[model samples]
Target: MTEIETRVLRPDAAGIAEAARLLGAGALVSFPTETVYGLGGDARDSVAVARIFDAKGRPHFNPLIVHVPDLDAARRFADISGPVEALAKHFWPGPLTLVAPLAEGHGLSPLVTAGLDTVALRVPAHPAAQDVLRVFDGPVAAPSANPSGRISPTTAAHVLAGLAGKVDAVLDAGPCPVGLESTIVGGTPLALLRPGGLAQEDIERVVGPLKTAGDTITAPGQLASHYAPNAAIRLNANAAHPGEVLLGFGPMQSDLNLSVTGDLIEAAAHLFDHLHTLDAMDRPIAVAPIPNCGLGRAINDRLRRAAAPRT
Candidate 1:
């Protein structure tokens, strides 16, 4: 395959318009969202959606999230039920995704859904994302802008590091604020598919208690081993082993600190960037124990998956 020159576009009016034109013409574009950078393509175009999976080496069975400008646009592609509507009203423009039954006659490519009957939908809070979606006026199927289960990219530099010559363009809008993927809520009996930037307790407060999904890969981030770095990762370590780089949280002396103040929110924003840093050091990575509370739960979830023995 011939290499595509990836343009680094600013998140401005002209940049948004050009990015939208690329998507409309079935080219892959990586753009920033509140959670993480997403490798996006026109969801309605099977060929374009196929490029996304091919570029990332993503599995066909692992579905992609369709990001729209607003809830109304989301309803055009997904059968948003009452519960999903309630959740959207509260969290549409943030780090939350709702998987609902695919609406009848929805024109999304089967590749985007991975042949599943449900469609994952999100309205990202990032200004660049909103601008791209609005100008494109269609659903863009996006997954973390990395080589499929690798560390999610939180900045344009990270996206280019993994996919610079692989994708068409990347809209640089600075570092992602959330720095984690969106929390995915789906399935009957209402279970949490993935823990992410949005806390599980907050979701439970909005809806009732949510059953955690079992080992089934019903949504993104369900794979037992994902979000990995090149270096081996050791979780919940008090200190780094010899020749290992230490990633610490909450006032711990280490090679790099997620947050010196022990703030989970702050730690969440720094997670992937720190992982990228440690991975580049070409040393084994050790992480100080993070408390399993609020955003820490999501942080630990990513760490555990990152530390899981790669297949």
Candidate 2:
């Protein structure tokens, strides 16, 4: 594992300045987002962005999202049209991502775009993230702060566990409230690039209906096999397969049941953490199919990817 300098940040000017300095120096800074901790760097710095891909072993073909201080700053990377602008105004500072054409002279590094014309942008609601971006002058190219093809980090420990020696710093902001990736909406007719902390219906209510992308999605988190753990995962009720371990959502249990709460929020909160634990259990894993609604949709999306036939 690559060794990285890790620092804990408090909500103070000193902490913000330290984080800004690390980013300015082209080092990867993993910080809290309302959705998940993000492994980020200066979006305009090709060298810095390359460091992120190298740190996470993230594929060059898969794009990254730009985290801005606010909607105004977000507009710098992408041209915000009427509908995109409306959604950003209403749902930004929350778990919503808008993909739009890059603005002229946006100066975003090509590595961040993976050669795509569009850029994925979001204004996270996490206070630590907001403050860091606010004090910093440049855009942060961030993806979920974890190893590529693994479960995303929802808490600082998750970052420390997977990225402790892989990045420069980590801003612990307690357990992520949303505990999932942001809802990415883009493409023609405005589709859901990835299901996440936000629901598809909530997005439609504000921006009208959205088209859900197919299995081979172009945006981040759309790959058929992603957000996986070390151990094999079986989705639906397929835990009974020989040698398979289990992660049940409600009453079911093959190895560990998330809970009897039957609440998607509760399940989402435990999802990745449980997957991590199951990996530690050193066995095959199985997860109950969560309902396809709200965060459940996002959770199931990850589970499906995890359970897909591994290469």
Task: Give the per-residue lDDT of model 1 (tens digit) for 85-192.
Answer: 889999889999999999999999998888889999999999999999999999999999999889999999999999988899999999999999999999887899
Please write out the lDDT profile of model 2 over residues 231-259, one tens digit for every residue.
87767774556777778877665577776
**lDDT against true structure, model 2:** 0.84
lDDT of each: 0.93, 0.84
Model 1 — which ten-residue stretch has the worst lDDT?
215-224
- Please provide TM-scores, in order, for all candidate models, with all chains considered together: 0.99, 0.94
Task: Enumerate clash totals for all models, in the order shown.
Answer: 0, 4
